[model samples]
Target: MVKTAKKNKIHEQLTPKTVVIKIAKWFLILFFGIYTLFPLVWLFVTSLKTNAEYFDNPFSLPAVIQFQNYVNAFSQANLGRMIINSITVSVIATFINIMAAAMASYAISRFQFKGKEAIFAMFSAGVMVPLNALMVPYFTIFSRAGLLDSLNSLRILYAAIGLPMSVFIVRGFMDSFPREIEEAAYVDGCGFYGRFLRIVLPLTKTGLVTAATFQFLTCWNEFVYANLLTSSPATKTIQIGIRYFTNQFTTDYVSMYAAIVIAIIPSIIGYMLFQEQIISGLTSGAVKG
Candidate 1:
């Protein structure tokens, strides 16, 4: 009788959540999952429909797939060129962003200097500043310097803007790292760059990949700044190319959907390829921390 009472008592404490609460939690998750996935499902459906069919039955599946829309989207809009341009810009920006943020984060985490806390505070403060507010001044400066409308110019700007947040994230991850590894490497005659390149970087590879992936996505899909800065066809990115299918009076929804599907290809591939890295980095930070 005493053992039974004790077992009952333990069960009471462990099973705090009632059946009704569990049911409600599952319902909430199901609702959110559908809400998030519905748009992507709609996009694929729309891409397969003709313009008339798309407008007439936005929710309905196509009777016959209009695969020509994909062909037209690329050929008519010169999306191939835009894809190449976006890839180049994104790759360059991602490289610069990851390198700058990684070095800055490592320095801030490991080194001791005067005003160190104040400098870290300044960097933290920069995260709260809105990029939109600085656009006017940035435009004026870039204009005077004759860097506006150039691919290299835009890359530098994107990397600079992305740096503050990237540094904070990387620094947060680096903070959880033990100092003994770095100290041991130092003892073994590894200088700052040597230790960083050979030891620190290998250990933080997942975090670096996460940062680079985000930077690539941002650089590739960035429309507002790219549209605002570059007016020439040669320098325009995929986002700009996608906009060509839309106008004031008439909009080619089929073509637009096709373009969107095409644009998603690279990002999807990137995510799939680096998913393991992202998962590992996030899980390590959450669980190990």
Candidate 2:
């Protein structure tokens, strides 16, 4: 029996079924890799081509690399200011979003109260609310509040808009957290605030980071509300500023591509930084919830 078991184990990976599965797995990986990366590669390549080169053959290699497109995007298009605006708004909004979500999620997950489930349901239900439908009322409210064209309005709106998803992710993690640690902390001369700030917050870092990354990206990439809210160049985000290259008569394709590449870099950087936490948060939530 032992020898037969050993033989089967040894031959398991060499079986036709196993070999076919291995090939299929790698084939899917290669296909997805190219699918996801090709557009980015094409964007970077096109950003280096001149207008004439792009007009001649977009897919072909550039005859001479046009570094000037980046320069023009920064100087002529004022992409630098827009990028800074995007960073500022996204960072502040993400902080606000995550903080509110953490508190709300903690309360919803760990504490029992009247209407708690209802409130949680409300927050979760917010994910179904359409931004487009609310634009008119939101515009009216912001206008009445004297917040139109203001970055603060954008920050607050971005935070509010991302709140539901943040709460959803953070609550999943918080629910999975063992309560014994909090109970222990409570018995050890720790107050409610201390238990939350020191014990719960520290342990929930992965969930917080995952939620923050999603919130930050949402704030960073959001366009329709941004365009609707801000008209001034100083207040415009990187998304709205990307359209400066286009008009009725002509479009600066290469420079637009350069600005796009610039805009994408920060998001990529952010994802890379929190990728591990995000992955852990997702898997842990799935397994534990």
Candidate 3:
């Protein structure tokens, strides 16, 4: 009797409030999952359809899958070359942005110097200055400098645009780290650079990964600067190349859809790989001093 009563009491402890909360949580999860995936699913289906088939049955599965759409899209967009350009620009910019941001962040977080706060405030303000607002100035400057159609121009612009946010994120993470560990390293005669490279960098891997991911994504998806600053196929990024599928009169729907799907694959893979780190870094950074 006592055992049965205890079991009943345990079951009753999970009240209607708990059940409602669980149901709401699952409902939100299901809603967002469908919301996020629906467009990709539609795009994939559309990519498999011919123009006639797409117009005939807009929302249904293709009678015959058109794998050639991907081939045509890849060839027509010169995506192979564009992909190489994007990868190169994104990787180089991301690396430089993270390295520079990490160094700046470390100094800001660890050192006390005149005008340090002012400098950091400037970086924070840079984050608020919309990229579009600088487009004209950047275009004029690059054109006059004869760098308008070069990969180096994109690389420099991407890194500069991403630096402010990267510095903010890395500095926030650095502020959260215990000062005692760094103090101990200093006492042991570790130089400032040595302490930063060995102690700080390794400990802040999540923050670095988060910043790198953001920088890479920004470079990958940037359309305005690439569209304005680059003209040659050799210099254009994937985002700009993808626009070739549509013009004023004719639009290649199948190829356009296929190109879009291909364009998004890298971003998807990147997010999947570093999702945990992004979440952790943001959460920790949010609470830091």
Please name the candidate that would achieve the greatest lDDT relative to the true structure.
2
2 or 3, greater by TM-score: 2
Worst 10 residues of 3 by lDDT: 280-289
Looking at model 2, residue 38 earns an lDDT score of 95
- TM for every model, in the order presented, reads 0.89, 0.95, 0.93
Tens digits of per-residue lDDT for model 3 on 88-158? 99999999999999999988988899999999999988999999999889999889998989999999999
lDDT of 1 by residue, 56-174 (tens): 87999999988999999998889999999999989999899999999988988888989877877787788899877888888888899998889887898889888877776677777
Error of 1 at 27 (Å): 1.8
Model 1's number of clashes is: 0
Candidate 2 Cα misplacement greater than 4 A, ranges: 1-10
Off by over 4 Å in 1: 1-18, 286-289
Point out the higher-scoring one by lDDT: 1 or 3.
Answer: 3
**Considering every candidate listed, which one attains the maximal TM-score?**
2
